[model samples]
Target: MISRRHLLATGAALGSAAGLAACGSGTPGQTADDAKKSEAGTPTVTIQFWMGKLTTGEDAWYKKIVKQFNEAQDAVKVELTQVPGDAWEQKLKAAQAAGKAPDMYIGVGNNVSVQVGNGELADMSDLLPAESWDDLTETAADLVTVDGKKYAYPMLFEPQTVLFYRKDMFTEAGLDPEAPPKSWAEVLEYGPKLKSKGRFGLMMGVTGADFGWQSWGWQRNVAGHLPISDDWATAKADDPAYEKLATFYRDLYSQEIVARQALGPANDSSAFGQNKAAMMVQGSWGISQILDEFDNLADKVGVAPLPTHDGTGTVPVTIGNMKWMIDGKSKNPQAAADFIKWAIAGDDPAVLLDYFKTTGYSKFPARTSVTEAVASAPDADTLNPWRKVIADVVMPAAALEPQYDWTVAEAFGKAMEKCMRGDDIPKTLGAVNTEIQGIIDKLKLAEKAPQ
Candidate 1:
């Protein structure tokens, strides 16, 4: 798999050498064909749908859903294709370049803006029924909206890095397990207490110093547009809050409050699962992972809102939510829309319940009714806690990744790495801010949203 840094570098080099070619013809969606019919004699339409790869049986579950939808319907026949996550972007680009894009494909973070800007994704604001659109959670609906139009419909929401701590560890440290730290200052204060028990207070990045920390700061709802200016033109790498965040992590490393392994490629959850770390910030999906892998530790683990700078509030940051979008060049637009409506926003409790169960309750549906149903179901005890966390903590104050440019995020990540290495924090951030601004100018990101 290509690292995002390498992908951005390749895009820049290619841009300088030849420029990105416009892909796809402005073709209209195909209408139902009379050439093919089901046993009932209704005209049939086959729509091509593509999704990214998943290992945890979600791939099979999606395929099963498609088969069920096909069997239950006569007007539409869906063709499903699973694309590897690493290659999905390249494949979509290639197909779009050749004017053969699939009817529907999954849209990930920041790509929604990129594709919408390039006119590669279909306008979905008025495509689905208004009720369907209204059913989406505010954050899910807002994430796909670019220039006041919805381009994609969210299927699931996986908020990143809600604070997961060990109740046993908290009790051992003479702290109240019922009351987790409410602010970053409290988290830092707990470090020494946890360290006395031979455990780190928190483990954030474990493998390449991922972007979780950035989201930590963004969720604080710091006074200004984070990592970017309000206009979305200038890089805000030099923002005081960003510098403070980087410095805080640097201090954590220097003080040995956080293990060095977490800064590397080791999964932090493993450390948490093994009781090596007293606390760590992880996605909602990690709850199922810890439960499934280490059932013995189930009662010991606890989930809460990730700490803010001053306990102001918490906001949900997108972790692994998948958004479905219609391809701009799709031939079966209405058929594809119909299928999405049925699968996602449809008022079918049985189907939605099965979808929630099929993924082991790792995915949270974006539809309010589905979420409520799952929470009320007596057999869904494993997921009921998470539903409360999502409702009370995550969704109410949700915010998006900077969305201006992926490179901005990459640049900030590099700056954080330099800080972790004990480099001059101010100088490193200053240089990165200037460099990112240069990239923004070169890509004309200020004039248009970037990929």
Candidate 2:
């Protein structure tokens, strides 16, 4: 998950030319006829690649791997560029409009569906080897596939909702740290017991945008559907299950179990790290920040999948992943595919393993081979003990984040905020349903929904 803080930080340096140089011996706009011919008269193809700038050292890993690939191979040359997260959409759109877009670029999470609809991404099913596609974890593979055609190659996946708590605080509050809350009812029951004068029992997003995206997993747990129906033609917010989910959060705010004002964005762990809350609901990437900022609290932290409504053992998490997609109009589709396969799904797992290590093992690997490599590493467990819990418990049960229009998520989020602010639940939900139906009709989303 990309936190608001990270986005703001990168957004500040919007026009700066960072990581814009092309790697290897290839230059941008090199045509097939311009490729260097070998002794066999076969040309070496060069492809352009772009990725969003991530705060987790992902850019560095990409640069390193691209350099390594260029030095080790002669058949395909790759030119790499890193774009700021905030500027990515505008820049990529301009490039594509001018017909100078990079051959391949990183696919933004949850927005790939829109890109696919716009014909921005190329079909990868016939470009890469079938076994390479088979190597991806089922959940990861499903995320990048639309209508049974692979549009992107997944790099990593992070669970969007994980329970992180303080062991010492749990003990002080007369709760068992070893057994965290397994249901929404347990969370309510335990939250009050953990509250004190300065610190609250829980920390989570309470704003409209925060609640909108952050509630995806919880919505699945409670309602088994998003605000829109599967066909994307009707609004489903009026369902009793959605009302129940909204009312639960409203009670949490009204009773002061959680802060009336948000401590930080849902993706951030600063409040928990500063001891303002005993427990927090955050993405799995939060683990990386905690370990880096407060190494002393490493031993005091505990992780578990977010609890479901009835404690029925459902994981209640949305899988957040980063993937690479080729441009639909790329002149070097095969060369671009070769680079992606070598970096992520190749026989050698060394590059991918090093990336996981650099991320502090906070992000989960998308490929089974990379998972095995990480598990067999000597320092895997010692470096991060939560890996097993996330892999064995969270990944299997997690659902793909909804790929519907952003306005649909915003509509549901605003309704959730209204209920939390003391508005009548039924009235607010009814209004939300009408508003969402308007969106569906205006956008003709029913016709766009993948079959």
Candidate 3:
């Protein structure tokens, strides 16, 4: 329940006071075996897994992963609890307060930051083979790690976002579908051509803001505005990257090429799929959905990295993986960690691929060997296509929240809403960045001071 700001303060204080004592232990808690002894008499160790709706068609793919896991193992039975991903923090906090919570659960970018920072997760440091884990992608691997201890594996892999264009729209606009814009200017130039079809050329216009603004915001992240580092805070809203970002957004808004109400809760935009909008930035999660919805989607839906600020050949597909972390307080840490190991092992992951027929590779396996196994998976028609592209395009980009705090994003959300409302670029951005800097300064001071 600790806020990230408070946690940073506590960490700094404890680091000074605990000094050498904190360095020897894997996690700042009682050992897993100690917790297990308290639950020794249970007939079957049902390891509670708080996960997104994936099992039983409430997001069936996740369920299949757990179901196959249960059938495959004898040491533990996974009790899969469906937790809405968006509200996972509330779920975890509520469950913790009630003394009823999952032993192992899925984690996304924000969850990892909040939970791991609070030390609510099991430090899978020694539970799983460290060598087996060494093969993970750095950004993907770092998703669940805080300090030197790791709590989750980057399970499903993808860049933060991908740029997809409507082939017909592009052709009509006289732009090549295969050759996407590489810089900020080209996208602006192409924005107007799709107007003949009554389609907005750019997303992030008020109409597509919810799903699209983050993509545009992430353009700054790919440009290297990270959250923190050993040297200093990596991301600052006032950074030139963000200033540039706001200016670019202002231009897009002024051009009137972006759709109105595109970003609001109910704004309808099928222009990208309807061959109306020329291009849109989306995540790997959208690939299968796009393929399913768009007629002749594969040929018509061109996939390319998003445009960069300086054409530095560095595209920021935001980097992250769906994560699974075990509760340090769980009664079955060993069993829980075992299940995670089994789920990711070679050939074993193919079982999950078999379960989700349509959203194949939507949850790309984390391991390289598993990726290879999926490459030749029997049901690859559903899985392989996305895996190849996601793997290729997901260059090491920025994570959503750098400090394991949503405050930065929350600040951006406010700024973005105002930007969409047509606020002044400099003053609005300066205010937001100041707010972000204020948070960062407090966290930094807390980190440096003694507890």
Task: Specify the highest-TM-score model's number.
Answer: 2
Tens-place lDDT per residue, model 1, 1-451, is 1111222222112111111132331112212223233334452567788887653456777887787766654546778999976688799789889998888887755468877768888887766778878878787787788888888888877766678888898998999988888876788888778875556777777332375343534424543456666576887778766676666677777777787765323223666787778888777766766755676787887888777766766644545577888987776566677677767756554556776765556567777777877767776666435557755667566555556667676777777778876889888879888988898888888787532
Which residue window of length 10 is worst by lDDT in model 2?
10-19
Segments in model 2 whose C-alpha atoms lie over 4 Å from true places: 1-48, 73-101, 196-198
At residue 353, candidate 3 shows an lDDT of: 46
How many pairs of residues collide in each model? 4, 0, 19
Model 2 TM-score?
A: 0.82
* Pairwise TM-score winner, candidates 1 and 2: 2
Ordered list by TM-score, greatest first: 2, 1, 3
Q: Name the regions of candidate 3 deviating beyond 4 angstroms.
A: 1-43, 53-58, 72-75, 84-89, 111-114, 134-141, 196-198, 204-230, 233-235, 263-276, 292-295, 310-312, 346-358, 362-364, 374-404, 445-451
What TM-score does each of the candidates earn? 0.77, 0.82, 0.74
Off by over 4 Å in 1: 1-46, 55-57, 83-101, 125-127, 147-149, 171-175, 189-201, 206-209, 212-224, 259-271, 274-276, 310-320, 357-364, 371-382, 449-451
Encode model 2's per-residue lDDT on 1-451: one tens digit a residue: 1111222132212111111233332434333333344223343566789887664466677888788766554545688999876688799889999999999988757467788888888898987778778889887887788888988999888888899988899999989889999888899999999999889989999988888888998887788888899999989989889888888898889889899888876777878999999889988888887866675988899998897888887656787888888999997776787667667766667657888887778888889888888888888777788988888899788877887888999989989999988999999999999999999999999998868
Better of 2 and 3 by lDDT: 2
lDDT of each: 0.67, 0.80, 0.57
What would the per-residue lDDT of candidate 3 be over residues 37-94, giving only the tens digit for each residue?
3245321356778876432332665676677655543335677778754577787889
